[model samples]
Target: MGPITVTDDLARIDLDVVHRWLSTDAYWALGRSRETVEAAARGSLSFGALVRSDDGDELVGYARVVTDRATFAWLCDVYVAPSARGRGVGSALVRAVLEALEPMGLSRVMLATHDAHALYRRHGFGEPAHPEWLMALQPTPAASPATPAV
Candidate 1:
């Protein structure tokens, strides 16, 4: 239990630890691969973190938001390490990410979650009333391969 901080640059991130959190069978799963996660983080306008173990600081939790720093953004791959669950890591991660981008003057930030709606709600995320108006198309494994092969 050290401190939680949000960051945008993932080339500076320790992805292996973040990957461990994603591998856990908790809350929801994105089924993302190492390369994709790395790519997403690297490409994102903002990425966030909640480091609970500073001295031994493994990347206990994380959240990522991809945006053009303007009117649209998508939040994705939010996770907390299994061992670090039940604490406020997820909440803090979400908060940190969201706060970081407020200055960009985004019209809205949208996200899709299989679970954890409450967490999002706590941070001012809401469901669209016209769910029917916002039809979605799921991607296939072929369409979204986990990661590029080394």
Candidate 2:
């Protein structure tokens, strides 16, 4: 990794690159559709990591934050390409995101991760003090006609 450039420019993002990683490689978004991924990109502030190459620049990483720009921000859909992993791409992306949000004076920034806790902790993230106060409502996937009822 040489001189990785992280930017919030949506113009620089390649949707197909992002969708490919999210749908196939990312555990959180496995089997996710391109339409869903595109909608997410459209609705949130996006960041992209581009590395300089002899031919041109390549989009090697991505992250998006859904924020009200006043109160709260939820950081989600962070993915670094397989070739970009373990080379500070993830850390650089997180730092860029934090810097971007700093001007907004947000009350809190939150993210859910089954792994990579250490990476985030290095950037000042920690376990919620009041986990009991937090809750989620993930909808069950619709059943198909071929599926038998319990």
Candidate 3:
């Protein structure tokens, strides 16, 4: 809510804070490591941003944009720490990613958010008009087991 710092440089991020945030954020599947985020940030040809909270030097949220820089972009891995919700952190992260990609000449950009529809909408994202036009092939399922230990 107060002044927060947002940066495009992942190299300057404190990965330990990010690792802790991902570990506790329910909207994000647990299992991310600082190494993975660092790798993606280094390897991604598109855009990414790490959001940090002003209060405690914590990494509160993150998002990445995957794009071809031609006609399309897909935003993914939107995460906001539970302690960091309701503070515009999520929306701020999304907006920063979108702004980064605006110059890429993309005809359309998209992402899927289950319960945060309003947050994305506030950033000019809308539901896909053709539900029939969208389908995803996971390529490979997430390595996590289908059934959790019980």
Q: Please write out the lDDT profile of model 3 over residues 1-150, one tens digit for every residue.
A: 455556767765565655665655644547777788666656653222334355645566677667777777777766676767888777778767766776775666666645676676566654444553221111112222222111
Which clashing pairs does model 1 show? none
Root-mean-square deviation of candidate 3: 10.6
Residue 20 error, candidate 2, Å = 0.1
lDDT of 2 at 4: 90
Give candidate 2's root-mean-square deviation (CA, Å).
Answer: 11.8
For each candidate, the alpha-carbon lDDT, in order, equals 0.62, 0.80, 0.59
- In terms of lDDT, the best-performing candidate is 2
Tens-place lDDT per residue, model 2, 1-150, is 678999898888998999999999998899999999999999999999999988688999999999998867888999999888999999999999988987786666777876677687677675433543221111112433232112
Q: Rank the candidates by TM-score, best first.
A: 2, 1, 3
- How far out, in Å, is residue 24 in model 3? 4.7
Off by over 4 Å in 2: 128-150
* Model 3 regions lying over 4 Å from their true place: 23-28, 45-57, 128-150
Q: Which residue window of length 10 is worst by lDDT in model 1?
A: 132-141
Per-residue lDDT of model 1, residues 27-103, tens digit only: 34446577865676677753546464536545666777777876666777777767777778788877777677767
